[model samples]
Structure formats: structure tokens, C-alpha cells
Target: MRFLPRIVTFFLLLPSYAWTQTMHNKRYNVLLICVDDLMPELGCYGNSIVKSPYIDSLAARSAVFTKHYVTVPTCGASRYSLLRSTLPRTKAALGNEAAKILSDPETAIGNEPETFIEQYRRNGYHTVGIGKISHSPDGYRYPYAGPKSDQRELPRSWDEVSFNPGKWGHGWNAFFAYADGESRITMQGEVPPYEAADVPDEGYPDGLTAALAVDKLKMLARQEKPFFMGVGFFKPHLPFNAPQQYWDLYDAGHLPLTAVPNIPANINLASLHNSAEFNQYRLGEESAALDQPLSDGYARKLIHGYYACISYVDAQVGKVLQALEETGLADRTVVVLWSDHGWHLGDYRVWGKHTLFDRALRSVLMIKTPAMSRCKVVNRITSTIDIGPTLLELCDLPPLSQADGRSLIPLLNDVQDKAWADVAYSYYNHGISMVTPQFRLTRYFRKEQPVIELYDHATDPLETRNIAERSPDIIRQLTPLWERGNTGVYAK
Candidate 1:
């Protein structure tokens, strides 16, 4: 009314429109929690021995994916696949693709003009990451809008805390410094005398991770802006350390035996390049004597240690969930819990991850959305790649053009009759594994030589027998499916 200048009037109208746009584009906050080298040992997954109270409760509120599988078994490869929503084989073929895509200003993975995090950021959400969200060390490459720091090491990225004492590297009571051909194990921390409170599960790094996550969540909730926080826990991996109390929970004598008596003679030497990594954890005569056969007692002890570690990690998970609820972000936030890949605790006579075995490839995927009516469990074969697209959908962001995975919103919403494919594909250095609802087929191709392994999971859930040599017709039928690299025809 006061005859304001035209430019001034335009500027005056801009703020209201911007405010409206911000409100209109508000996206759901995401809390992505990842664990390293964890298997499906939680109570929700039907593991009676492992005590995962927090995850079990979280599963009660979320849609638990019973048949979720990682695209790769290794840490670096699996993390890359999940973050990019690309098949592991595709990523492997495009070696260094992750670095290339992230560095490209024009087409960053998950930062394209319409990428999920970019869209959320544009809509005024704060994106922050903690711990090992990226394949790179020190949380190097993520869309973190805030401080980034490696709490574990120097040359920190953004912001970091100090490492928790007595809880590093799987919480092993003994510390080993790798030097020359010989390794020495010395007691780094005191194992409390057989007391009720001195369990190994209580002393693991996962507990530290959980405490840090809880603290971070509390701090973040004070800010007005909604946030996407990634909290990663490193545990149940190696060094097999837990509180002595956890060790006391199970008698080594009563622990389960290894599935195999010894390493299979049929496994080629080339397939065992990283054998030392697994060998480092073997106990008793095999570990002490190096080349000697593993004793039954030592194998049982290793298994017992592994179960204790899982329970320890599970307790840490409970702490984070409690923090989320306490901070009042539980209702508005979308919570996604995943493991990079499964681990092998004496399955197939292999002691670590890196193979295409089901014990190493299958992981846990649990998604809790604010929109879901109740807890549901989907047993369909799903790949880790689907996680990226699912997060995009949850944030109300358009799927990235380069994303090979389809959104799993339909599945979460109880649309069971929707058509989908049976096969979920994974890959390693030179091996390819294709898993269907009832079968797992692995094909190894190296130097033009072909080797095949197949397991009917329905009949042999432990994968103790290989039926590939006996079933040529089944192999022929499934080989093409693996070659196609498509789960099934779905809308892009």
C-alpha cells in the first residue's frame, strides 16, 4: 500500500514462498544403523543362545526381512553395493567406481540432483554420519553436512571422540601385534574372576559404539532441523573379545562343535589366499602349533566366543534403541538396521567372511517406518541394494536414475501378491552366487575354468552337502538366471 519498489516487493514475497516450500518438501528423518560382520544371531532371527533384546524388540515394531542377503561378503564391497544400490558384480566390474562417482560433481552417487540425501538436504534436513558408514576408513565419503571425525584414529575428518578403553577390536582380552612371521598374544586387560558381572559380551566395541550413538542422538534431537544419522557398530568380527562374564555364561565343554572336522582338501589353494586372517583366530593346537590339526575343544571354544560376542553386540543395539525412544525421535524417524554381511563361525570349515557361502552372504535387514501399521516379517529374497531405494522412498525423494534396486515400500505395506523375482544375486572376486527361495547356486569362474556349487536350502539349511555334480539339469536351468543378472521384470 505504501508504494514499495518492485524489487523490494518481489524480495518480500520470496520468504513466504520459501517457507511454504520448505514445509511442503519436509522429508522423513532417517536413522540408519549398520553393524560390521554380524550374522543373523538375534533372538528375532530365531537364535536361542544369542541375547539381542534391543534388536528383538525393534523387530517387533518394524518389518523384519527374514531372507535379506548382502551383495558381497566383504566389508568394502558390500558397503559399496548397499550405498550405491548397484549389484556387487556391476560395482566390481567398474572398479574404483565409488571414488569416481563421489568425486564427480555432475553425478555423485546418492547426490545427483534428485538423489535421496540431496533431495532431503534440499528439503532442509540435516545429514550426519557416525562410525563406518562408508567403505572408506574414518567415515571418509558420505553426505555428512556436519562435522565428520574418526573417533578411533588420528587425521580425523569432521568430529570425533576418543576410543573406549578395553573395547577395541572385538573386545579380545588379549592383544596381538602382528609382526614378522610370529604373533604374540598378551593380556591387555584384566578378566574379572568368575563373577556375575564380568562377562565378555559387556566389554566389546559394540557397547562403546552404542553408548556413542545414544549420546549423538540426544545431542542431535536438540537441534530444530530434522536429521539423517548413520550410526555404525563394529563388532562380532574378529579378535573374538567379550567380557569374561559373557564367557562364563556358556561352558566351553557344552558349546556346539564345528560343522566340519577340518578344512576340506578339495578347496583349491588359490581360493585360500586370505587363509591367514581366519587362521589367526583358531584356538588350541591348530593356533599354537600353526600347522597342526584343530582340536574339538579349541573349535568349541571359538564358537562359544563368537556366540558371546553376538550377545554383547545385541546388548549395545538395545542401548541405541532406548536412546532413540528417549530422545522422542522414534515416531517421526525411519529406522533401518542392517549388517554389512553375515559371518562364518566354523560353517563349511571356513572361519571368516569372503566366500559365497550362505553363512557369509546372508545378512539381516530390518526397517521400521513411521507409516507402517504394525510389525510384519517378509521372507522374500531381498538384496542389500534395495536399501538405498527404500530409503529414498521413505524420505519422499525420487529414486536416483542410476539405482538398480527397486523400492521395497510395496512389500512393507503388506502387498504380498505383487509380482517379484525369486533370485537375489551376489558376487565375490571371481565367484557368483545366485540365491532363490529354496536353492543357492554358486559358480566360480577363474582363468577360463568353471566350478560350480549348489545347495538346496530347504533340505539342507546348513549347506553340508553339494548337489551340483549330481544335478546337471537344475544347474543348466539356474545358470541362465544367474547370467541374466535380473531378479525379475519390475517397473523401473
Candidate 2:
């Protein structure tokens, strides 16, 4: 009887042992790198001027997404959508506190949506985050001055949420601080829109963020379990601050200006603003206006500063990637680099991201999986929210139950698949825009007047003219897409 019991125990243990071994052998790690306000302007994306050698080199071994669009133009709202794999459910979801608000048990509904990072942490992975992964850069709740509270922004998402604010005392300060540690709030609109300090990368917060991520990568290398590490860089977003070396790389004379700087014809003044965000920096050479254009010299200077910031962020990315190689974890890691949303250099006489145009919604997205080949580009219309589900699929994890995004695995596996969604959607305030291969249709529920805007991408890629008056048939066809994207909200 004793021998029979021993035999049965051994048989039962065999399956469990084999399952453990399989899980151990096939566990793939993830490194998610997020950049703020980055568009597809790297050399890899055919922008010959931007000096982004590191990101371009990484793109050579990754799947570059050419037409990836975010659900919203602002950073916090877009990041929230990416993390939850869902669209914004309320107007609060479009603000800087979107994550903190949506994840609260008091405010959230239906058992609360699970962030992909939380999902990984639950499934035996060592999940970590540093710098601006959420609305709060430090991953904690803090005020402007110092001493962040222990309360987490995403409560249960990270095993380790760490950041080094460097010269500035805390995350929010560093977010708006310059190379010399002078913060924007302190300056109170006294500073210029761009700066090129004669200092090393450490003079900015991103360099410190890179160093900390590299250290964490080293620590995670010794552990036997897998890791999902997120590193978010804040640069090229505001202040356009970069090391002087990066700024020196670009010549102001040769930098290109926006081909379309005027507002579109037959458009309501409500459709565009006077670039209030850019003008808020008091030291700017000129205040943006709808009735006038910025001086050519001043415009070139701003573009030059934007390019320098891109290079600065690119250098920090290179350092973190190098650490992965040094730790001998490169082959086992899935690398994903993306931006929160796009920014307008001079498009439509606007200088910020609070618009429904492609200039504000189209962002840079690239991924390099362990099984992916080198230098592949996918030109399909994809959303930023699709990333969470794609990572889950690649890691062989179960699908997220509350996810509103579809996996991009099909497109990654074969770029020519025809079953993908042709339209990409974006929303801000009371308006929603649906972008298809042929047209971008937008509608606004304004109390003053009913507005409809349509632009044919094939002919008016710059959106310089709205053809809604002549394109009635196109509007009827695209209205359903716009309605479906709105999800029954803001349709009045």
C-alpha cells in the first residue's frame, strides 16, 4: 500500500515539474521605453535632419509603425489609454490626473480596469517603472515643491517605482526644470521656449533616469524570473531644453519650416487657437497669432531647438539600450519604444498638441520582439492602445479581460494582412476625429454652432483646406466610424 501511494505521488509531480520547467525556459523579458511629444522624425523615419542615430539604429532591428495614432493628443490621457488598453470614459480621463482618477476605487466602476504592468506583476513577473510612465513622473503623488507621498499613482502596478530627480528636488519640478535646475513654475513665464545649456546629459532629468534604469537592468539580470521594466523620458515636450552639444549639431540656416503655417480656408476660428501654450513662455520672440505669422528667423530657431531636444532624448535611450547588451539580456528582451503623442512645430499656426489634426495625433511607435527579424516596417493604421495587448500576446500571457484594444501580433507577423481596422480615432474636448486612408472626418458638438470638418488625405495631406462643403457623400460614409469611436459619449 505504501509503494502504491509513492507511485501515484510521483506521477502527479511529473506534470507539475514539467510545467515549471517549460515556464522557466520560455520566459521573455520586456523593456518599454516611452518618449514624450516625439513624432516620427528620426533618420530611420526619413527625416534627414534629426540626429537620432541610436533610435534609428534600434529601428533597423525592429518593426517601425509609420501610421500609429494616439486616442488623444495630450500626454496624460494618451498614456492612460496605453496602460489600460481602453479609451477615455469621461472628460476627467483627458487631464493630467487621468490615471490617479481612473484607478481610484471610489471613482472607478466595473471592478476597475487592470493596467498591463499590474497584470505582469500578478503573473510572476518583476515589474518595474521609472520616470513619467504615468501622469506623475516619479510614480508617486506629490506636490510641486518636495517630499512626495508614499501613495502610488497606479497603486498595484509596480514592484519597484524609482526615479532620481537629479538637480531638481522632485518629479514635477524636474519635469519643467532646465539643465541648470531652474524650474518653470519658479520662473513663472520669465524663461524662453528653448535652451541649449553647456552641460553634460546629467544636467537634465532624463540622463539620471537612464542611469537608474541601467542599474535596475543590472539587478534584474541576476534574478531567475522575468522582468517588465518601463523607462519614460521627458524631453522635446516643453522648454525644448537640451545640452549645447546637441544644439550645435543642427544649423539654424538649413532647418526647414512648416510648409503650411496658415489656418485652413473656410474654417471657423474655433477650429484653431493662437498658440497660447507656446506664447505662455514670456521670453518667446513673438506671440502666436491667427491674424499673423511668426517671423521666419524665430520659427527656424524654434525648429532648431526641437531637433536638439530630439537628439538629447536619443542619447539617453542609447545608454539604456547599451546596458541591456552589457547585462547579456539583449536577446531575451522585447524592446518597445513609443511616444505619448505628437506636437506641431508650426503647423496650422499652432505650437502644441491640443488639436484633432494628424500633426498632434500621429506619433512614433516601434517594437523589437525576441522573434522579430531586422528592419521591418508596418504601415497599417494602428492605435497606441494596441500596444498593451500586443505585449501580452508576445509574452504568451492570457488576454486582458477588460481590454478594448486588439493585438497587433497579426500585423507584426505579416505586414500585408487585410483584416486590420482601416480607421484610427482621436478625441479632445467636445470633438472627435476619425482618420482613414482616404479622409479625416471630425465633428464637434458646440452650443454656438454645429461644425463638421473633413480633409482628403490623398490631396490635402497638410489639411490646408476643409472639403466638407463639397464632400457630403464622404461625410455620410465616415459618420458611422466617428459615432462608433465616440462610444455614445459627446455625440450631442
Candidate 3:
């Protein structure tokens, strides 16, 4: 090598390393907010009916992702994919039992694939998980009808994982709880799927969770080390229970039902299912059928309940954001709000998220970092799994070598980037969906009555028409992209 001055040689040899060091020294705090079963029904997503003012405000300060998706449509698998920064590597990762399956020491990759939160904790950041930061709603193990287990969902990730079930006592109980400490478990099938109780925010479990998170923020603010605080909110998911005030924000009669409530034309009806998840509440007025539309009155009521829960969760998020500002941590923190997966409100005649439909796969994702000032919408395709690598890169951490997602920092820096991935992938059991910029292609790995459905997003944004039979060239173009998503159990 040619001889040069010490300073000049050092700069020439380590420009990228020096930048990473400087960024690492900044010690930016990370606020990861995970909302459960939230659809893109916010005011920012151009739905004027939903009263999501706080999240909308956050969107104004953040790079809003209009085409973001998850790797799985169901909650546990979707969250598992997001946290692990990988595609579902096994069949168990595709179910609600993902915590037990993916975190088990015997079968998990390297005795549980290292979580991004665990990486943050290892990097000397104090990691805190408030509610359902993992597969479980309260970050603890629980049977569907029993008390909670002593086992933590991600045993080695958090410096502190705390939740206040209040009078509901445990996680699953609080999951279907209402105001005044009453949960569905104690109500004996008498309680309805939705409730608008006349009480304060603390009347519901999410309200209590918000209060706990605020207190945690205050505690984290006093700490000397940078923190990775994951605040998970359980709302708008099921049993759409909120304080009556949030319900008062909406007019039931004015709220519109889904325009495309029937099965898509020429698509397999097997792709859609009855609203079994919604009907499980035991007191629902009517069970959603694959053949029949929900009653107009019941549909309005469901919409009202859904919006109420969204507003309620929005208020809780507002409190946390307010705390961030008050603690003087806003400037030093990177705030990201994401939903596990999207839910359906009578779309394709489905009331819950189970299908490989775009309504279930596409979700809400927004990231606000200290480096970005002007808010923009990133229309480029992205996935929730990309979140892990993005956070790692932003914090100057080492790359996750096994991660399936690419860092979205490029899009964050320039929202109009054209060289981004043109497709997003989502999976449900045996079915796989690939969402390209202008189309959605789904394939079910079935030996009997195999299904390959395609929807052209250019003209049918609602995915009401399956054009696979009419468009052979498009199918040929997108088939490779669809097959590339066949990881885990679906892989050949």
C-alpha cells in the first residue's frame, strides 16, 4: 500500500465503520408498538369513518407504508415471522401455538431463533415488553380455559415483561374481558362479542395496559441506558370491548359495510370461510355463513364495535406517545407502530382473518425515526418481517445473517425508490399469497381440487374478480414470485 498520513489513511480505510460507530454512539431508543388484528382502517389510510386521530398524527410524522404486509395472516405466525426476521421455517410457526413451537428448546432453531428484542437486549439496551409482545396476549403462557403458566413466551428476551390483567386475573381472561373487571370467562356465554361500557379507560384491559406502559416509559426515562420498549396493545382484535366514550365517537347508521362482501367471482369458495372466530364469542346474534351475507343491522353493529376498539387503542397509543414527548425521549427514540396482520370486516363474507385474501395479509406499518423529518407514504412493497432488519440496521447492530427480509432503510430514506421488492408474501397453513404492485396471486398446495387464484389490482382493488382464467401471461409472470414464497411447510 502507498504511504499516506495517519488521519487520511484511517478515514479512507474505515469510512463505513466510522459511520456505524458514530450511529451506535447515538444510542437511539426504540419504541416498537404492536397492535393486534388491526386493519388499515385508520384515518391516515383514507378511511374517514375510523376515529384514529392519534395514530393518524403518528402517520403524519412517520413514513406510512400503504402496501405493507405480514408473512402470515394469523396473529401468532405473523408475529413470529416479524420478530424472528425469517419466514416460517416449520409448520408449527403457521399456527396460534407458535410460542410453544418456535420457542421450544428442543425443536426451535438454535434452541429458539434469536429474537430481535433479544439482540437489542444483548446490545446493552434495556428491553421491556408490556403486553402481547410475543404470541401470547400477556407475554405469558396460558391455556385457552385455564390459569397462566410460569413460562415466559420469549424466555430470554426482556429485561422486564410486565402486564396488569387487573380483575381479569390472567392473560386469556383479560383477552376477552370487558370493563368493571368482568371477562367472558365469568359471564358464562351471556356476554356479547362487543361492549360499550360506561367507564373510564382503566375499565378495560387495554386501558390498564396503557397505564402500565406509561409508567414503564417513565421508568425507562429515568434509566441511564438506551431502551427497547415493546408495547403491545390488545384491541380491535376480538370481543371489541371499549369504553362507551370511544363508541360515542361513531354513528352506527352512517358506517358503511364492506362493498365486496361476497366471494370473488370465479375464485374457489374454499379460499373463504365462515366467521368462526367472531362466532366463538358465544353470544353473537348470528353466525357468519359462507353462503349468506351478514344481516345489515348486525354488520353495522360489528363495524361500530370495530371502530370503537380502534379509537380506544388509538387513545392508549396517544398516551404512550405523549409520555415519550414529555420524558424528552421523542428526539432520541425511533417509534414504530405495526399491526400483526389485517382483519376482515365482512370482506369476502369473512368477519375474521383466516384466508389468504389481501384483506387479511396487508396490514398497517409506520416508522418514525430521528433522521427523518418530512412524512411520506412508501407505496413500495414491504413486509412486517422487514422490521427486524430495519431496526438492527438503524441501531448499527450486526446483520441478522439468517433473516429472510431486506432492510427497508432505503425506502425510509427515499420513499419513491423504484428498485424495491415488487412483491409481498403471506401464508396460511397450506395456502400462499403473493401481492405484487398490480396483482395478487394465491396458490393452495392441495392434491385434490388444487386452487390457483389471481386478482388484478389495477381495476379491482377490492379483489372481487379472479382473472387467472383470462390472463395467462400475468399468471406466468407472477408464478415464480409466488413459488419463491413457499417457505416452511409449503415448500416443495
lDDT comparison, 1 vs 2, better candidate: 2
lDDT of 2 by residue, 217-264 (tens): 999999989999999999988889988999999889878888787888
lDDT of each: 0.61, 0.82, 0.82
- Candidate rank order under TM-score: 3, 2, 1
Name the lDDT of candidate 2. 0.82
Per-prediction TM-score, please?
Answer: 0.76, 0.92, 0.93
Colliding pairs, model 2? none
The predicted structure with the larger TM-score, 1 or 2, is 2
CA error at residue 106 for candidate 1, angstroms: 14
Which regions in candidate 2 have their CA more than 4 angstroms from the true location?
Answer: 1-26, 109-113, 145-147, 448-450
- Model 1 residue 110 distance off true place after TM-score fit, in angstroms: 11
| Model 1 global lDDT (CA atoms, 0 to 1) | 0.61
Tens-place lDDT digits, model 3, residues 1-492 = 111101111111111111212244768899999999998888888776788989988877677788898888888888888888888767888998887754576855573336888888888899999998887877877685667888888877888889998888888888889776777777765677899899899988888889998998888889889999999999999899999999999889878888776788987677887887788778888888888988989999998999999999999999999999998988789899999988888887799998888788888998888655545667788998899999888888776777888898877666555678778888784788889888998888776343788888888878888888888898998887787887757666
In candidate 1, stretches whose alpha carbon ends up further than 4 angstroms from where it belongs are: 1-26, 89-119, 141-204, 260-274, 280-285, 288-293, 372-374, 447-450, 486-492
